[model samples]
Target: MAYPTLRDWLFSVKTFAAAMLALYIGLAFELPRPYWAMATVYIVSNPFVGATRSKALYRALGTALGAAAAVLLVPPFVESPYLFSVIVALWTGTLLYLAVSDRTARSYVFMLAAYTMPIIALPSVMNPAGVFDLAISRTEEITLGIVCASIVGSSLFPSRLAPTIIERTDAWFRDAAFYATETLSGRIAGSAISGARQRLASTINGLELLLSQLAYDHTRPDVLARAHELRGRMQLLLPIMSSLADPLIALYNSGRQSWPEGLEALLADVIKWFNEPLPAVSEGYHPDASADALRERIAAMRPPAAALASWDGALLSNALWRMKQVVDVWQDCRSLRIIITREEGSWRPHFRHWRLGGTQRFYDRGIMLFATVSAGLAVVLACSLWISSGWNDGASAVTLAAVACCFFAALDEPAPMVFRFFLATGISVLVAGVYLFAVLPHVHDFPMLVILFAAPFILVGTLIPRPQFNMATVLVAVNTATFISIQDAYDANFLTFMNANLAGLAGLLYAYLWTRVTRPFGAELAASRLLRSSWADVALTASTLPIEDPRNLAARMLDRLMQLIPRLAATDDHRHPSIESFRDLRIGFNALDLRRLTGKLGGEAPAAIAHVLDGVRTYYESCVNRRKREPVPESLMRSIDAAVARVISQGLANAAAPTATSPTSARQLRDALHALIGLRLSLFPATLTSPTPPEPETAA
Candidate 1:
């Protein structure tokens, strides 16, 4: 006995009111295409006031830019249709590329920039002089729709993104806790961990979107401030968690060095601490002191600087430091969970501070470049075919083709979706005809018009939130508005309506054909490419200058890893995926670790480290190529030995000289060497572990 929720009813009514008002304004102004205003209402109305406002603003701006582009570009090349089409195609391609690359709501601007040119300019190709008026009408109608949607959505039982943000934030940490538990256990299978990683990445991306949605919400200053703080804290969780894994993996692989004393006890205590209930934000979390005490005890056992050259000492010391980091992150997570949950409202004083850096994502330039070409080709082919046919309704085909290409630009498999769009267009045409002929013709007044449209608008608006139903509903709403064309004086012409509808369907068909012919890569292949590319980047990171900003590169690589994990987990053999995925990630972390430590080295150490890095790249390149595994060559092993010796000796010399500006960080240097060694062994199991430590003179 479930009933219609308040949210659904209010959202439906707001959508209906916005559409009716926009239609009234459009009819009053006598815009050339009043249907556009009506259609824009459904397109922009969202459940949240902030989301609605944000989307409407961006949509309005994008529409204006796109309209202006069509006006300026179409008239100049009108004399040459092919030249004009090509120019328009180039503009569409460039904008589409930008739209696909951006991951935020701002991308709506680029999407509009890509398709609006075709919608406006292509229809006026036969009469270039009319382009200006067409652009103005398009802009004015869209603006009217945007204004109506924003006003109605904000005023009547308006929703706030703060609540949605909080909901998502809660879900994010729940998944994060599950992921953290697995990672800290140190005995979990790769497949399980990889899947958890995928969820974490998704949560991070979700949180990011919620953070952006904050700009639109104005409900609670306390909640807003807490959310900002939570997002910054969330950023540190991934890197810190990633850092902890290296030590666990190193300990697992080291058969010669005995486990560091009290290590297992510490791990058990941390796991127990993590298992405790997360405190509510209002509860003011006080971290358990046992975890901190364990970490301090571990730190007090650090080996003397001279003892670091011992392989066992290096392994133990590094493990302890990573354990300390694990504790810090554990404490941080518990504290943040409370902060994010606490609703301080206006009572929370906002502190002005430099926010902690968040994870950065990389956009693959090469893929974007290729996408630009494909988009341009899609437009050129569709437009050229329409022009050559000289069909009276060519505008519909040209416009739909560009719309399909621009709208579905984000999908890896665009052809199937294009076909769906084609089917949806056909269905929209059918319902649109029923409404236009049977109901709209009888409507004599605006009040009657509202009644006629009420059911369709409310039902469709309710379904808009559903992922599967959204596309079809939107198409129906749009086509109904366009086809009915309810004006003061009715013009009932069947052939004109049929021609327009068929042209719309034909446009989708053109897009479908173009995509099928191109044979774009599907999700699996794209994901595979992403994994291979990440490996290449890892190898480059290992070999090249450590000066480059690695966070963005790492974030992108992790992003790809996140996407790849589910696909790999779905395959038959989960063990191999676990091994390979975690293996590569472990290697990447080690490379980053070494790169950071190398900055501390002096004398011949820099040159020696460079030699080791070159060799390290060669080992990973083999993994990237999926070639037969090889031993770390004797020469490369010798180079690593020399580099380690140089760093250890330089640190001892620095300690001996009291006047030195800086003493070499012996523990960190040893940790770096240990990470490189661990990476070497992980890459090549066939090679026997070096039996003894390199002597001081031989290393020199």
Candidate 2:
């Protein structure tokens, strides 16, 4: 590895100190195993100080919870090892499902909880009386390690997440701005949009981790609201950029699209601002107000009604309209930059203003349910084989298999990961044996023990941030420390150690077999279920639920959109889910607008409009319950036309009043009409194609 920075060296030093402290504490207290505490120091240490504390707390809780379960479970089934094994397996499986569902540090608690009982109980099957004492010892050692790691990380010039968040956001904005320039410059390649989508999505994901750490930081809440604002604004940009690109692409294909006058100038301004050297956080930044001027110019210069429908006029209209939108989005970015710099202290309303709702990872219940059953069954199988063979080390196999299954719970293909872990475990055993018998005899003091172990731990801290072999490094370090089993009085027996290690290998071998057999299904069921879920949201949108805010609702559905993109991209099959997923995105957005538009109705909307919504709701519900593609009734189609006319007249009548609320009415009507148009396209795309209607919905 390349030489680490000063921060990396500091982290390594802190982790090493914590591990030695944990060992000393355990030895001084005469705990059964000081090594467990020592090893946990490495396991819980995180570069971010707050993350270290968070993980430490969760690990402690998980250990205690697991120990409590072992205490309750081990004694009753001692006589019948088979029944006990099955019960334990089921417990691990159930908890494993919950563990993988949350893709955060919190998952550590559930994973530890799932395995803690078996770790204590399995070793004492023949001597069940010792189970409670073993569980207590295990829990205490683990908790001691957690406490040591947390204290060391928090005290030793701890790394702050706030500065990292700022640096990361700046880099992300630069990439996005470059992409926007390429898109507007008409140099966009066929793959560019998808690549941009993935990059932006990944950035959003990374930001969320930093956002979660904000509570642990001393940063003012008003400055943090910019992140929330940026997320919402960024989400809007992708769809708008995509929508704008489509018409431009069509015009380019026909050799009609050209950059509108001053469009490149407006785009250049945004690019330059984003690419500028970032100022210190205290510096004020006034956003370039060029967007409003460009928008007004475009509005004033729009073509007359007749020429707009012609091919040449259509090309210019699409280019100018989308350019204005791009400018608007860039302006929003500059506004967010100003807030992030904390330039305006008077905006106290922005403090604590960011609320993250509906940001959970989308785990299909089917996957979780499938994993829970497989984990339990794999354990039961391992146990039955051991019990029938009358193996003294059979409990080892049962516990190892159960723990391994839960450990790889989040992986789609567990067999490969299990094999990697198996390799790491064997390497750990060799290292542990070397230290147990070869080095420890001469190391008579705690300080000498720390010196002997310091190099190995420093290596772990060095390798922790690596992407490729980090997991293996972790397992080797953890397994070696755990297998050494340091106590006040050291006992190193070759036969007993070899037997335990071999049993663990056997358990992992069978686990790999089980994982290969019960591999996660990648075909239709998950895709179908997710598509149906989006339809259910549409049905909800049609219900009496208030639609005052669609951001939360949209955010939740957008998560499923991300899920669908990857699944569809993985397959080469015909009738891909991507088409349906794209349709669902449009449907979800439209449903929100439809709901909002309907909410503002004062019994003035045409009665036929109500009937049209009812029919659409029925169709959506049908899609959810069964994958039926029931087309909208021709009568409902006609009513949509009538509703469009009603909305247009109302918008026009309100146009004369021209208050702040007038623009809102205009926007609502436009959104409602856009939803109706999208509904028409989705329901009967091939058969009922219509020319693009004018803005006031004057087309039949």
Candidate 3:
């Protein structure tokens, strides 16, 4: 093998060495094994699973407290298995409940308290007099394991999460820029606009997760500050983007179809605007005449072709102006070169704020809790079954397997991860067994043992940052060291280590196979259901007739489409792939179209309602391909705007028609107008397609 490849191979298994050395020290010196398991579990699980530093602290604290509590309780009820089981179950339930009820860092404490009780307390019943000694020994082992794991993880091959966050954020900004430009241009419909809006929201969600990690870890202040600033700028952009939708749509719906020669030049100017330094506001440069003249020409444009052309011109002008402003602000901020504040008091971090009703639709909380509990139970059950079978080493073997499984399972939601855990453990056992039996007897010196132990950890730790090989090497080293330390070749310890390691491997395989069989269908089903529901919503809104109450309906449709678009993007099934893709495309188109109509109605209840209904019919026909793609070739978007303008003009004329009409007739007309406005607002809450039905009725 090449020298670099061989060096890399050795470096990747460094953590495994640390784990092995810690376990060997504890077991070889007759220290307790459970403490090592506790420490190893915490360190390995935290970094492997992407937990924040605060969470790791909570977990450590909880484990320590639970272990202490278990030491106190286990002895008093040792003779009665039934009482012990009940106490364990009740204690676990209480901790789990507390974890569920709380939303802050304290929740991790509750989770730890519940599970720690079992690991520490149950083992003491085997020998009451030796309980304290065992507990102390276990604590020592755990501390050593934690220290080793942390050193290996942080120093050897640390994975810095900040770069990933930056990359994702950049992608979000690019997508947002495209979305804003498209909305201003009025080249897409309301549904497409809504889809873009939804994508923006999703990107925000991802950013929040990254920030949470940084906060929990107490990362550099400058990084957090930059992230916060970016978030603020993005928030400001949303409202401005929303405001431009109507004007662009109106211009598109008017008669002008082609961009004017000067307007085309302006569009090119805006596209290259992001890189340019912001223009300084000079004195007496009133340059207002040119803009006024352009507006007049836009107003004089006729139907169809005129609407499209005028909209193109307006969008280009407005976007160019806004782009200049944004670029200026960006340059100013960059030039200040201000370091992000690291002090806690510098800014009130809003990362943890959960708005009212935000949690209603996020059902993953329950599933996460359930999975944790299930893992604990699976371990306990394995131990019980093995002990009942009267196999002398069965109980210990099961316990070892259970602990190993628990460590890995805690980090990942899906079952496949457990396989990695088992593989690591099994390989460690085989390698350690071979080393202890075949190589150890030949090297009696303490220096040789130290070299043997240190070499693996340093090598594996160094390579742990690599994505593919790090975990496997770390796991192998950990399991091997742990097994060799606990087991003595001349005694029963050797056989016990082998059996326990094998059991752990078996448990992992079972979990992996079971999950694959059960949850394989979830993603596909979610995609199909969301698509059907989105289509149904479109049809229902279109059917509402008299076309005067669409604002509320349009809002509702937009909400539903937001939830569905992501799911469609994630699915990989090739069955009816085009159908799903087209459905998503149509939904995107419709959302943008609806938003344009909303803008034209300008809060005129009856007119806005009528325009939405018309838009919905067109949206639906486009979905089914019933209306040819070119049906609105003359830019009917402009006609819809004109119709809206006419309705508003007529309503004003009627309101000024004076007391020529009866009081009852006037009252009825006013009530009808009021009802129309209410109906338009009501459309905003329509049910959106979701991977799962949301518990809340409204979209965030």
Best-performing candidate as measured by TM-score? 1
Q: Write the per-residue lDDT of candidate 3 for residues 1-700, one digit (tens) a residue.
A: 2233543444345445555555556656766453255236324433332343455566567877777777787788777755665566566655665665444555667766776676666555677666666666655666666566555555655555555565565565566667656754654344455456557766664565456556545466666766656554453344334433333343344434544445444433443443332223232222223333433443343222122123243233333333333333333222221222212222322222111112222223444455455554554555456546755444344444444433443232345555676676667767778776776766655456656656655565555445466567556645665566533333335666666656556656655554444334444555454455455555555444333344444434444434444554422232223223333333333333443344333334345445545664565456455422222222333333343334334334445665554555433333233222222212221111111111111211
lDDT of model 1 at position 43: 82
Which candidate has the top score in lDDT?
1
TM-score of 1: 0.85
Better of 1 and 2 by lDDT: 1
- Checking candidate 2 for backbone clashes, the offending pairs are none
TM-score of 3: 0.57
Candidate 2: worst 10 consecutive residues by lDDT? Answer: 347-356
TM-score comparison, 1 vs 2, better candidate: 1
CA lDDT of every candidate: 0.71, 0.68, 0.47
**lDDT, model 3, position 181:** 66
**Candidates 2 and 3, the one with greater lDDT:** 2
Q: Give the runs in model 2 whose Cα sits over 4 Å from its true position.
A: 1-3, 185-189, 217-233, 247-278, 287-361, 522-532, 535-552, 565-583, 598-667, 674-699
